[model samples]
Target: MHQADMKLCLVLLILLFVTLPAQADNAWQAWREGKALLLMRHTLAPGSGDPAGFVLEDCSTQRNLNNEGQQQAKRWGKLLRQQHNGEITVYSSQWCRCLDTARLMDLTTPTPLPVLNSFFAGRGDGDKQTQALMQQFAIAQTAQPTVLVTHQVNFTALTGIFPRSGEAAILALPLTQPATVLARINTP
Candidate 1:
């Protein structure tokens, strides 16, 4: 074969043999294998903070998700179910936006977790809350992928990563050890 033709064939072989395998071995695979925690910030709420008289039980009083945010949440749910074959566990903060996002998902109903609640806007104890979440993550079984729908502050406090609205951070569990970020699933 000609030298140029041989080089072209070699390049194709490298792409198929080396690059393909690396692409196939993504962080999603680790999440699918139950080795990571999917930490998701709630979708766009259309405001910086809640209103003056915000109430946890009443969504209208809080900075709720706008139409676009609702659609974003649904799309994420669809993508997650499609990718994981409908195997997922969703835990969410009690905040209206977080709960709405979780409920819109196709996964299991989100159990209200105070630990997952946002500390932003002076809502609660940031340090204690983050520690509580870490403790649960450290001991909980990881046989099935777990999704935590929370806020930016909670995520930052736990993983020191500030995810964008509707974004997700894949964190390796066992809080006693140094945290490892496996992936960052951006908005769809």
Candidate 2:
């Protein structure tokens, strides 16, 4: 990344942390009512992007989650279990880090959704992926709580919020154009 762009990203991260949401109740309430869609970035994987010769089919070729990330994911799962009772459909990106994060949560066998896949290495069209994600539940998967475990780029494309790893944005229903921002969560 360019120095200037890197600095800008750092600034944004600082701002997001500084403005972390205080109304945890409201965010939980939306979840309890099954009126929100959670879009979360996968937990920490040490570095920024995948290494050279990054292969999608091989976990060793990707950035997998670290021990700290594993702990964070487990904590989130326990917390979610405490907060929302009933089934939670977890949709994960095809990336190893994302899949592992979702699996560690144990929130259900996370269904791999292509649209939730990271568009970071020019792998997919961000705009198109965002649209597909929004339309994914237009007819079904609306009655239950759904969580999309994905990458920072997917969340940014959908909500214009550059979410930190392990951060989440709870979007209001009908996740189409101009989706509502219900809450922002920095999960453990």
Candidate 3:
């Protein structure tokens, strides 16, 4: 084989290795059946931590979803609409990125939850925020599935599963001290 062809094949292999499909250990089915919670990390916001002078109420002050992220969130909406026809309850962090992602999902109007906000970079107390989130979920249980759109830090604190941009983890109900992660799905 030619050197260029071999290089092309190597690149393809790397891409394949990195983009893993969500491992559904009944989690997908559970989510579709409205038995699990859907916790999502905000989609492809281009930058890292919030920029300086970050303000919770100000979109320009925070790191936010890019056009690609908007499109990705819409895809998630389409996927969710196809998967389950039952009612859904959506919650999102006050962050622009998270709120935008949840809104784009089109599942429902996302109610902002401060407990779901990112505690990364000393922005909030991770332990306290995580605990509050657990408590909130415990009290907010419903017959329909609940989706929480948040940041990587908040979700990781809850499930110990660091998420990719636009990733969703299927977590078992009654969110406990040690959350039961049923499955994970990256946006289609």
Candidate 4:
């Protein structure tokens, strides 16, 4: 091969290595700047749908997080702290699993926000719930980077993307425009 060709190849390789990390840093910067919101699905909870006669006030009646989920939540908290320098505010659904996942993250104490509650299980409240969340997000105060720990139903309603439990979508919020997804982050 020609020396010039080899030199060009080396330059391309260097750019490839540098460009990828720069892009990743930009994503994190947007998140840290509060220009983006992290919408996260609650961590693993075994079983589907609640059992018969489930009650909102009774956690025993609801499906709770499994052991793996607990660990996953904790890991997410650690990662966020490391990434953001310990500045994170988490809002979570009132459901047991959502609350548990948020708490396990070990960030600031999770606030139970009704808007983040799941409308799944044939509740038929999807539209109402989604509107409430949108309104709340629009007015939310941005003192710190925030994460909302909710369910798959809410994630789908907001972003039209069905996220797995424990996954997060980073979205950019503009006051006059609809939120746009900047990236999707998954726990490693």
Best by lDDT: 3
Off by over 4 Å in 2: 1-23, 139-141
Model 4 residue 27 CA deviation (Å) reads 2.6
lDDT comparison, 3 vs 4, better candidate? 3
Candidate 4 lDDT tens digits, 1-188: 99999999999999999987776677667778877678899989987767787788899999998988999899989878877985788999888999999999898889899888888877548888887777766743366788999998888888888888788877775311235667778854
Itemize residue pairs with steric clashes in candidate 4: none
What lDDT would each prediction earn against the true structure? Answer: 0.82, 0.84, 0.85, 0.81
lDDT of 1: 0.82
lDDT of 1 by residue, 1-188 (tens): 99999999999998888865454356677778787778899998887868999888988899999898999999988988876985688999999999999988767788999988878877899888877888888853497878999998887787777778999877776653335776667887
Per-residue accuracy of model 3 over 39-158 as CA lDDT, tens digit each: 999999998889999999899999888889999999999988877777788999999999999999898999999998888899999899888888876742456777899998888888
Q: Relative to the unseen true structure, what is the C-alpha lDDT of residue 65 in candidate 2, on a scale of 0 to 100?
A: 92
- Kindly give the stretch of ten consecutive residues in candidate 4 with the minimal lDDT sum: 172-181
Cα deviation of 16, candidate 1, in Å: 16
lDDT of 2 by residue, 1-188 (tens): 99999999999998877665545567677766767787889988899878998998999999899999999899878878887779998999999999999999988999999999889878889888888888775642367788889998888877888888888878877786656677878867
- Candidate that beats the other on TM-score, 1 or 4, i.e. the better one: 1
Which pairs clash inside model 3?
Answer: none
Candidate 1 all-Cα RMSD: 4.9
